[model samples]
Target: MQNSATIASDFAELPATASRGPLRIEYRWINDAAADTRADTRIAVFLHEGLGSIAMWRDWPQALCERLGMRGLVYSRPGYGLSTPRAHGVKWPVDFMAHQACDVLPALLDALDIDMPARQRTWLIGHSDGGSIALLYAARHAGALAGAVTIAPHVFVEDISVQSIAQTKQLYETTDLRNKLGRYHADVDSAFYGWNDIWLNPAFRQWSIVGELAAIREPLLAIQGHDDNYGTMAQIDTIAQHVPHARLVKLDACGHSPHRDVPDKLNDAIAAFIASQT
Candidate 1:
């Protein structure tokens, strides 16, 4: 793992925010120095977890972009990172994640001028909540994406997930978890409640993307850890059952965050999957 000081230095020269209205998005680009200077390599847009921000991703995105010989876009959603804070006393609607998938992502893509004609090939690499957003985006914008790699994404709220979230709530209240998360989220409460309230909501408990999974025809790779406490292997299993052609990878002795827990193994698998698609 890259130390916080090193991560800070890498991001030190990044461009400052140009706007802070309805959405607070920051952007960065990575160019392949090793390639023939003229070619426009395809890009990978990384979406972080609910509590994650660009700063939290550290050097992983940079490392991946370098390894794949591609550019990368890493940003913070509204209410996280340096973006706009969530409205006070506002509770996210049950379909908040859907809104993010259908609205915010497209808006950000357009804002960054990433919607080029032949540049239609986009690779989405998302983690946890971001992973779910990636799936939803692929479901809606079918042919626009080359493929997606999702790690520990949830299609529905499992009992295990709820239980773990409940424990997280307790930890937040009684321990230093909030302070730890504060390092990532600009407004930790906003980020926490935005995600926590939705998952614990009665209506959201039954929320499932099984229908959407079937609609996704793009190449898909869903990865989960066998020892993940927040969700079971059944999440990816269900996706595979719905989208029979989707490939599934179950990592042994791993937890929810595969990229963080098993970086080399996860990167190798993702690289092979992307190559196979081409």
Candidate 2:
């Protein structure tokens, strides 16, 4: 099976005129199984970071999907990459992640004709903002997920995280970060500001999903780097404390991106966790 990221890159390498959808939501199949394959096979969905898109994931999703013998789906959220751009002047609400978890994701699945069984066994692999979104989804739609792997998820805002985000704002305004992000986002401002404004809002500082997590009964694997600049280990630690069967893995010499920073270890850990759930 090719990783979903590699498939996405190949799609991106195609002519710009290639039509996907209104939002250019490119959905690719990673496994070569027949369409009528048994539902017992796991399907992993890749959710990108705050600044990520389907293209930014490189070959990691594909590799992980193959390693786990699972089908994979990767898509750029609205306003990112080939996805449809958000309307001008539209701002994300404070509970944007909640909306994604409660609404957008389910709709996306429905559109793709992916039905959730009474006891579904799918996995969610989410990074950064996507990780938080995954947690919210798992909390509300517990029957839809068998396990989840979150890398560098933020449960609450920390002083360090705020400071780092402030620095990012400076970089976006005064440095090449904006130009760099433009490569992945059609509306860079929408993607950046939507995430930034929400996290920086005063009311958002009180945003914590620990209560929701406490209600999650599914297995979870929370991985974080000890040296992550954007968030602290406390994020995953908090998940472990709240979610009944949550497992925490702290990676050394890693940063906010465990899949990118420690691919082999991260993949092994995720594969093992998924296998145990099966």
TM-score of each: 0.90, 0.88
Model 1 lDDT per residue over 1-278, tens place? 23333433222112323432356565555444523553556778899987788888877887787777777778787767766668767777777778778878887777666665423677999998899999999899888878899999999889999899888888988999999989877788988888787788888888888788898889999999999998998899998998888899899879988878888888888888888988
lDDT of 2 by residue, 1-278 (tens): 44444453322221122322233454555664622476567788888898888777878887887788777777777667766666667777777788767766676776676777612767889999899988998889867887788989988888888888888998999999999989878788877887777778788888778788887777888989998999998899889888858988888999888888999999988888777777
Q: Best candidate, TM-score-wise?
A: 1
Error of 1 at 62 (Å): 1.4
Location of the lowest summed lDDT over 10 successive residues in candidate 2: 10-19
The residue pairs that clash in candidate 2, if any, are 3-62, 23-84
Taking all chains together, the TM-score of candidate 1 against the true structure is: 0.90
lDDT of 1: 0.79
The local lDDT score (0 to 100) that residue 60 gets in candidate 1 is 82
Worst 10 residues of 1 by lDDT: 7-16
Q: What's the CA error at residue 98 for candidate 1, in Å?
A: 1.1
